[model samples]
Target: MSSGPSSYKIFDVTLKESVAMTPSLQHCVFYSEDVANMARHAPDQRIKVVLPLAGGEPPCLVDNGGWYPAWLALPAERRPPMRTYTLRNVRPAQGELDIDFVRNGDNGPASRWVNHARIGDRLQLIAPNAAFDGNGSGFEWLPPDGVRQVLLVADETALPAALSILESLSAQASPPQVQAFFEVPLCTDVQALDHYTFAKIHWLPREEQPHQPYGQSLLAALQTRLQIPDDAPRTQDEAAQGILRPELEQMWESAAPAHSAFYGWIACESSGVKALRRYLIHSCGLQRETLSLMAYWCHSR
Candidate 1:
């Protein structure tokens, strides 16, 4: 494991509340009076959360009076577990940020901690600096210019980021037409999203069909909704399409021109994401520059 710099500033936060979005989904809010600077974070970006391990040392403040994360303060061998969660919403006026956690019956440390979190419980958050230093932050919702339509697909783990992206898009003066598919464990897991007038949301409940694997429902929905060409090219020619790379970073930086009208973004379990990426590029004929595919998590890992 790698440790962050000792000089890294960690914000001390207190839990505001943990609300049940559904039987198995939770919306956790944490607030810090010093987080007004968080307004600089792009919508749907992620934050590193450091929760104290059971029986670990309490958090402390550095000479600058900024709280240091308890997990980071521990010796390398004793550091607590840490996780990254999406910033679902930010209220700079109240210095609050919301993170949605899906409880899987204590299968993961973060889920277990969030399941029992209460009001006024202290926690620590490592956020991107106000200057936007391009470190310790992750954001990938980049739609190039002239995109007029979008297709978004995600499972429950990525629902928070997907919703945040939708919210950001809806705030635009002329929002693009959006078709979003979300797969969740329960139908009730589908919550209302405000200011999403231009979006068509589809909720798929996997609990209704026990044998269906994660991401299959979303893939089915995509197949039914989009008209994938039967004779679409399997792969773009390397000489004609410019140098192709396997990494998203390299593909994203390539000076390839954007697809004319449609953009697609998919995030979910690793296997599903890879399958969807292949289908979109080879079957749907979407340009690599117009789609963003990410493996939010893996079921087998």
Candidate 2:
């Protein structure tokens, strides 16, 4: 299959420097000759990063039946171990790009590189790739005109996508009320993002205990704050409603009374997002076309 016209571009960017976006978040401002030649990207687009791991670091991209073309044809040691991250923001006019890295433990090379990234750090960035139309605002399920309310959900990995979505929605002819949810390990993990929108943002901190189930806790808090109703059917419907059924139902009900259609973007753990998608489709009766569910980082990926 041929990529008709590559929506993604590859660039070599030198990190002029890094800034502490928050106690747990760092902003890496990078520049590239390639970035200067690229075209403007939609707000929700993302890029792929090719990270070279240190010796003895476990290869994150494995030789799996040649399934990953991006990593194929390279010597094992020098092969780029790639990770996809949302483009937090782009200042095409200034020829600068921003990507936020959560200061999680450096168990992985990407995390390690980000933690120690500094001035003159070299990084390769594939050009911004347009979002899958189905999961993007371009999808038919999203409000064609304007909505009164919107709900955004994601873990730290998905925060960038959520932020971009909110910012894009803010620029619409008439934007909706936006509520963003993010969960990270540390309370200080929260950071000030590009405030190009008029949405109310909320952050939830995940416990740091090893082996603690952060996914379940996030679902619970979201359900409580959203006031998911107690009248949900207890059997098939409940299970079909997915992990956050009650909360999604509440959102649907509330938004309905105001003639508002919601664009629900949930990107997080693969297992968890499967449930969120189920709730949106099976429980809340949301049109599948309107929901954007992405597994930013999956355990099995």
Candidate 3:
């Protein structure tokens, strides 16, 4: 599992530049002469960024310190310090780094910083950190010997990580059959993704006048579309869980009896991911070792 760096100290850094990923997302690039001073980082890892308060200061270190560590070791008001974001890309050789921010507007300091960020802006940085891999290895049960297919299911938040994994997997190994389900607001959000073996990408578009939060409904529909027949004898109570249970049953009903294998990756809203994880483990009889499940973001957090 990951931990704070041995050389834990703040770095005075500045925004080298920023660009638009979408109308609502910005890619902020930062530079530091002290880049070599930080610890090694990993994809999906997070770091804290301090933003100056309105009219409090301009390019000034307003918070008690220039920058503070977030998501780890801090006071109460600062408990959930700075918005936690993934390290999108890094270049140690060039002394540059990039983190993409989902523009949620002034509701958050981090979001606000990104919304107004300009070239040469200054801010504090808690050196790049790594993700916790409590299991002590990479995706242990995947690529089960002789397995030749891959399936990735996720929302926009997990898209970066999913793409990185797919590109790496496609380049070195014989391309595995891949399918992806992505949820995004508009059609333009669809862009070139790395080619994988027999890839089929499904896009679930957001509504103009949203009938409801479309992600939940899309996931519910997927559950309905993938359901197994009721006759397979297992447990009676399995039918009680809403929406996703039948999909799990269907996945099990469709699988081979013995060693013919499939690898699954899923990340999404917390409740939905948790539901799928339970179904994969309990109802489908999938080894916890065989599936990669992550709750990328929570609804109410």
Candidate 4:
């Protein structure tokens, strides 16, 4: 997290392969000599992807903890667009990493690049330095000890992280009961994923109810499944149209509940996250510490 051996490093990586897992999801395999030292400490491990400059040249970067300031110090013209994403899978021995990109056409720099990304394309990844002591730099999937039920929710943007968490939980000796609600652009966007018997995945397709807002399907499913407090207000869209929290910064919080038997990890649009955070805590009486409600993105520019 800082200038230390156990923190992070920027690795220059080349895309070795790309597969269209779904129309909206691209599974890309990247290779780098230094990736062998990249650590996957948590299921939902976050990392930064530095996109190429206007001419498709590798963006200027510093391969150390000082990358952020150093990158910002560069002239605006030289500052590449950096985006956050989850590491789906990591094969340290194979010197490879897997990242799933949502192919949202021109939504932002990452989407634009993934739309045109091809084998041999190169980028910079700021990830954990496994070469030294283990560090949870960009990891955030921590549930309370002995949690009985885990609620995992996400839209297409956070699907990579939700799936990664599911896989890791399944490997546990005694996995908790998991109820996952994943909303994608369409049913076709759903892919076959690996999970355990205790995991019940409910894939909500916005296509069925084309009239509803993008994240309504997920919210409806959650309400129907979970118990809302008697005093909880009827659910409404919370997409941050008025803008209380910024998309990337105020959108993130990850601390497990100290005493609750249930834990939740929810990530979606900013307003939805805020609305749900309020309902779960104030309305439903879910402890503020019982969840990691993250706004993975925002609708605003």
Query: Highest TM-score among the candidates is held by which one?
Result: 4
* lDDT for each residue of candidate 2 in 1-301, tens digit (9 for 90 to 100): 7433344445677787688767777778888655555543455466677676575333344323332454676577667667776667767667788887766667776778888776877767765434312222211124433355566777877776676676677677767666667877677777676564566666777754346454554565555664322331123445544545445532121111223344556677766666565654665556543456666675541
| Tens-digit per-residue lDDT, 1-301, candidate 1 | 6343332356678889899988867999888887775633556587767776666443443424333444446587566566777878778788898888888777666787887777887777766556344454357776766768777888888888898888788779999888888989997887776458898888989887788777888788888876433332234555423322245322122113344466677788876776676566655555666667777777863
The model with the greatest lDDT is 4
lDDT of 3 by residue, 1-301 (tens): 7343433345567789898876655778889886765553334444546555455243233333223433333444444334445556677677787777767656666777777778888776655423322222212124555455555666666666666556556675466666667666566666566445466666665543265453564465446543322322233344333334544532221222233345667766666676666665565545444456766666663
Candidate 1 regions off by >4 Å?
1-9, 56-77, 132-137, 193-195, 227-260
True-structure RMSD for candidate 1: 5.3
Q: How many backbone clashes does candidate 4 have?
A: 2
Score candidate 2 by lDDT. 0.60
The lDDT values for all models are: 0.70, 0.60, 0.56, 0.78
Error of 3 at 17 (Å): 2.2
Q: What is the lDDT of residue 170 in candidate 1?
A: 74
Model 4 error, position 261 (Å): 1.6
Q: Show the lowest summed lDDT stretch of 10 residues, model 2.
A: 250-259
Q: Write model 4 residue lDDT over 78-134, tens digit each, in one string.
A: 888899999898887888999999998886889999888888988998887786664
Q: Each prediction's TM-score against the native?
A: 0.81, 0.72, 0.66, 0.87
Output the lDDT of residue 270, model 2: 66
Those runs of model 3 whose alpha carbons end farther than 4 Å from true positions after fitting are 1-11, 37-42, 50-80, 127-147, 194-198, 221-261, 278-285
Where does candidate 4 have its weakest 10-residue lDDT segment? 228-237
Clashing pairs in 1: none
Worst 10 residues of 3 by lDDT: 132-141
Candidate 1 structure lDDT: 0.70
